[model samples]
Target: MKNEDQAAMLLLGVGGGGCRLAASVRAVYGAGLHAVGVDTDALANRNAAAGGMTCLLLGGSRLSGHGTGGDAIQGRLAAQDDMQNLQAQMNGVRTAVVMACLGGGTGGGSTPEIVKALGEMGIATVCFVTMPFGFEGQARRKEAERVLPMIEESADSLVVVPLDDLLKDAGEDLMLENAVNIAEGIIAAGITLLWRLLSKPGFISLDAEKLHTMVMRGGNALFGCGSAAGDDRAIKSVAALRGCSLLRSGEALKRANALMLGILAGSDLRLAEVGEVMCEVNKSCKPGCHVEMGTVFDPAYEGRIELVALAFESWTAAVMAVPKSETEVAAEPPVADVIPARVGGRKVRSKGGSKLSFGATGRGKFKGVEPTLYNNQDLDVPTFIRRGIRLER
Candidate 1:
């Protein structure tokens, strides 16, 4: 590997699903890219080599790489034990990307912990994760929801793709394996374009620091990757991007306050084509939005154009810069009443994992129901209501 390869962005895949994605990304980008796949299952680690990326087998003593048997705690412990080795892979990389599919044990259990570990390194981390399909069962879906907030808290920002949404438009004759393979290819292509924008600079030159500000300073985001070849490829590529299911067919883009676009084109890319793409982007966003643009000229895409666009919520540029009107100005967001932590109850820690230790807790209006643990908080009936945290519309 060249010095460029060693110091370029790092892509880390966690668990079986993530390893497959890492492999897919490696196959497309080839040299000048470092990819690593970590898993508790030795078999998953082995099978992940379809594209020949580095693989790490974790939890040799406890799981012996036999697999976590769909247990998240085991998956988490496996990654925890091998954390030093995993962190070593991130050294010197400009940025780190994590890929994982939630719902199963290893992906769900270890993803948040892995994000937390990357956070400790003070590197800008972005995660692209998948939620379980509606048909995948309540247990998996619940598990995905359980750790989602934690993962968001750990990573700078993340893009979540629900499996059901991804699979909704599959053709009737498409086999499940083929559908998964197709999705992985698309994902790999997107990852390739993103790193190209950072490591391989073009005329506009968006560096690691600028890319960091675009991603890390925003809320959760929507990402889409698409490509087109032949006449008017730039316009066609942006159209393809707006049509991807992962981006909710661009409905999310319309609501976003912060947007970043990375374009990869052949040496023949024209200025007019660039202008057309920018026009489409400006038309899509409302006034007061922040847009970042970067382009890379690659001989590999000589006759084609590829685009990777990310749309995210921004408090500074969008929310604060709302349009003004003399007659009726926008009012500030409503503040809801605060919920009390101590509602006439004696707080006591539970001895084991099977006990509720709140004594004589008076849950104001919820009437009858036991307190449940959410985000590491214990509370009575209607936890959100009792906690006084109203959900914003």
Candidate 2:
């Protein structure tokens, strides 16, 4: 990937859990990655800053940098207060990968506002949010669920990772701390794979432009990754990926309308291995699924193969087409050649216009009353009718 492309993308972490996740991804991807973390807790911000990521404290004056204490409303207000500071960090960024863990105050509350801000700035955002584990109790789960729709509304592509599903394969005896670490590691690895696919030199490159276009069309996505080594590493990696709980044991692929697959391996990777991986993945996916494949070679990945897949279930090609303005829509020919019209107490047929009453142009009894106006436009009449625009059938 070129430096310009890398500079255009940003990895943003919101709140404590989100900051930690961003730190993990940065640690794996190293120097070139541009990352920033925003949180209500001053201490947490300092810790994340220690990891070499730029950190900003939200609601420093109002909350005194203490934190929201799981109050999502406070978190939301904090983000709003410090929104300009966050926007300053987004100078040249065109695509933002936002990581947040829902259920907690900052993550649940601040994420929606931040994502919305990024969208308003014309930055494409792919949000990766983790839902609380079942063991975390009903309250936390409910909190996460409540904030989900808000994030979904603003994010271009949303990848939801339910912690319960993520840790299902871990042994029941696993410690809570270890389980959390493992989940973060797995998610970080998948994100790293995606970053490498776009930033590293590869046999077949998946550039930032392509990623932006795909994400614009990919409403919600499923992300998962797996690794394997030894003679049959490529095949084994695919099998492991198929079994990934995040992907619902390959069910996501079957239902996906589009997929972005990245293969990372060492210099010894064989041409046949690449073919084998693709072939197996293709078998798992439904017919007519759009697949974008890329391969990355690095010395660090010697003797192993890492496979990452992002499945977009709601992918639609219609979004790729440019939307028409009201003027353009109104200019289209009417569905019917002629329509009935009233003229001087006689019925007449009018050509090139539909008989459909798009909407009432004037207020019936309230016409003589004072009209409500906004920005110099009368709010009493329907906007289309006021603008003198006709609707096509």
Candidate 3:
């Protein structure tokens, strides 16, 4: 990859709420990294540009009728579509940092598809998912659970950031915008570290396939830290740990000959969680490797855990490297039904798979739910051709 494409950022807006989150990051850091956003919504492109980043709108709806059978098929199609769209957006970038909010419509439904496509091309894809608070109740929970596995399965590494957790000590200043801002800060810091490490002397190019394999096997760990409670001492402790871990990580990268990294949140976490995160990261980065650190706390503005970071190594690479057999595919339950569901007022068929709803009882029946467009319509020939031609999947 050339210098222009070496450090790139791929932002995928999966759900209704994801755009705000993606926009938040783009708003803060303009131009240091190449930003590309994808959404099923037609407004996605506008939203991305408004946020000060470049983007592509896949133009679709979020609902696909419980994501099974036909929904799954559509999901695959959407994934293919996204890859094709993204291929043109890609400028031969070496490392791609993917950010998307989890749960909700497009981000949740389509993220896995994008990952699979990029992984096939040997590109390292790291996902940043903003999980809803349990307070949002069941609807969000099911969304998180459903998408979690897909994100894990498709990406090189995934860092899950719980929105509710970040708000624990947010004080009066905490709001959706501020929360996203915080998350973006943490994410930016994490990605910057990874980029710096990769650009350092003695670092060689890492194959995307190897990187993706390492992340899929749970070879990654998450850590959260923020000073929502105003505890600077505790915050510093976490920062110290992260710093040490980064140093060791760089060392490990040199020895293992690891190539790429995926960063989730730039900010949006507490300070106290850093050390524990680094410790866990070191453990996962190198199975038997150990890193030492200490912790501290403060009463005012208590530091807490908020963000998650991922580290990869040879063992993880090996786990991800081994290909799954056909039996492996058949053994697991289908994520959703394959048949399309009939949307009322139009010709639609139900997709088959397990149906899980998170919110409100009596709102709709889980079984035989109508299929909503990923953006609310069937794939047009031009769009379909675009995805097929680009992804080549």
Candidate 4:
């Protein structure tokens, strides 16, 4: 079938982690949500089936569902061998929202390949991934970081939430399982807000077309959702989101070039409160960001307000070739081509080994140009570096 004839938003779960996250999203979204969970683990796929996802067990010849045993390369190969099978399932998908927890073998390996396949078929994709927790060991962390750019390469935009940061506010008394569940809820909520903003109109409408424009313009991105009840709900929700470890609150929120802010509240929502929240969030962004805002009023949120913020760096245009609308082309700012800096004309730059302030440059390469040496193993670097793609200002 031709690309234009096939159309639907596919929520694809890549591996065990991805599939698990996908399942959670499917539960909240309920019926009418097109969701598929693909994995190399037969057991995991079975579990996903129990949760109402169409589970696709990939690469029968390679692994036979025993699992990847933490080998991402084998996971990648399995997905590659089963590309036709994966493509068969994507016949009508115009856009795909990929969910996965990175760092493990299956998710780390198969996600990029799946994303590449979608993009090649002219289907735009937005990826939401979770990095490993600090306690998950440096090996997993390294793997997650290594595959990041590869994921970014294939998807139109990427939203990465560090697991460790997501768990920062949870006290030591919180059980491990509960913490993990809460993290899942946060991710599910964030994407749910975006989906609602696009699919369901509110008092201040943010339609699907405008959303795709923002998502396509976004490169690497950050996502977070926070809610508060009772007094000062609006300000408190935005403040909570700003202080969220998952948001890297200060860093990611401040550096985003394009941002979509969604406010969900009850009919009792105050106009002044909305203004205060937007003002506070705008204060966090670099000056003159392209901010798309909307509000959804629900009786369910009588005394509560929730905030979902998705922010992107300028690099989102790196791989995306979509043509900007006439208005977009005409409204280009003076510093659009240059790497974005924080307000006050301050260029955030890291030298030697410190973390830089600029979002486009990324966390930092290392002490020098050397590949990161973790536990005596040399990590695989992105092609941009090997090809000497100019990354910094």
Candidate 4's TM-score reads 0.77
Candidates arranged by TM-score, highest first: 2, 4, 1, 3
lDDT of each: 0.71, 0.80, 0.46, 0.73
Q: Per-residue lDDT for 1-393 in model 1, tens only?
A: 358655656888988998888888787787557888999899888887556778888787889989787889998998899988887777686567899999878888889888877765556678889888776799999999998977876676688878766665565687878878877876777777776665665687455555655565455788776678998787788887787777788776677777778888888899899898888877767776677788877688899988888887532342222234545543332223112332211111211233333234544332242232222233344444444566899
Error of 3 at 166 (Å): 2.6
Task: By lDDT, rank the candidates, best first.
Answer: 2, 4, 1, 3
Per-residue accuracy of model 2 over 56-158 as CA lDDT, tens digit each: 9999998999999999999999999999999999888988999999999999999999998887676778899999989889999999999998888777778
Candidate 1 residue runs with Cα over 4 Å from true position:
1-8, 169-172, 229-231, 298-302, 318-393
What lDDT tens digits, residue by residue, belong to model 3 across residues 1-393?
355544553544443355555555455433455566666555545656676766665534432223322233454455555566677776565446566666555666667777666655545566667777666688757766787877666565566667665455455567777765665666554444443333331122344433333333233334343222345433443343344333242343333323233222223334434544554445434444322221222122233433223433322222332344545433322223211221111111112332533233322322233222222222111233323345456
Question: What lDDT would candidate 4 get against the real structure?
Answer: 0.73
- What is the clash count of model 4? 2
Clash counts for the predictions, in order: 0, 0, 67, 2
- Could you tell me every candidate's TM-score relative to the true structure? 0.75, 0.81, 0.52, 0.77
Worst 10 residues of 1 by lDDT: 342-351
